[model samples]
Target: MPTHLIIHGRVQGVFYRDWTVSTARRLGVSGWVRNLPDGTVEAHLEGSPDAVEAMIGKMRDGPPAARVERIERSEAKAQGAEGFKRR
Candidate 1:
């Protein structure tokens, strides 16, 4: 499954991107994550259904310092992304 996610709350300075990258890679997911200008974190995750769902669950908590309020999820087209990255 390929998904687009927008995470809200204290995610910008909390190493969320780094954590997402590592976690996604570990899960055999491929995509990119970036901090949006609107104080949100946006990511494109593409992999197996289990991996994508697991990633979304992890994003809910984020890192130790992160305070995730909510996540907006939607369907996304597969990009055949090579590796997870911070964009």
Candidate 2:
């Protein structure tokens, strides 16, 4: 599945995006993660259903520093991305 995620609460400045990149890559997921101006983090995750779900699970407790309040997920078209990144 290709999924868009908006992560909220104490996400920025806590290395959430870098943690996401590492986690996504480790899970063999492909997509991009970026910090939003609204003090949230956004990401696109594309991979097997299991991998995507796993990635999302990890994102829930990001980097030991992030206090993830919630996450918003939605379906998205595949980006055909080769790897995960921090945008």
1-87, model 1: which lDDT tens digit per residue? 889999999999888999999999999899999989999999999988999899899889989999999999999999999999999
RMSD of 2: 0.5
lDDT of 2 by residue, 1-87 (tens): 899999999999888888899889999999999988999999999999999999999999999888999999999999899998899
Could you tell me the lDDT of residue 39 within candidate 1?
100
**What is the Å distance of residue 19 in model 2 from its true position?**
0.7
C-alpha lDDT of all candidate models, in order:
0.94, 0.93
TM-score, cand. 1 vs. native: 0.97
User: Which lDDT value does model 1 have at 67?
Assistant: 98
Task: Provide the TM-score for each candidate, comma-separated.
Answer: 0.97, 0.98
Backbone clashes for every candidate come to: 0, 0
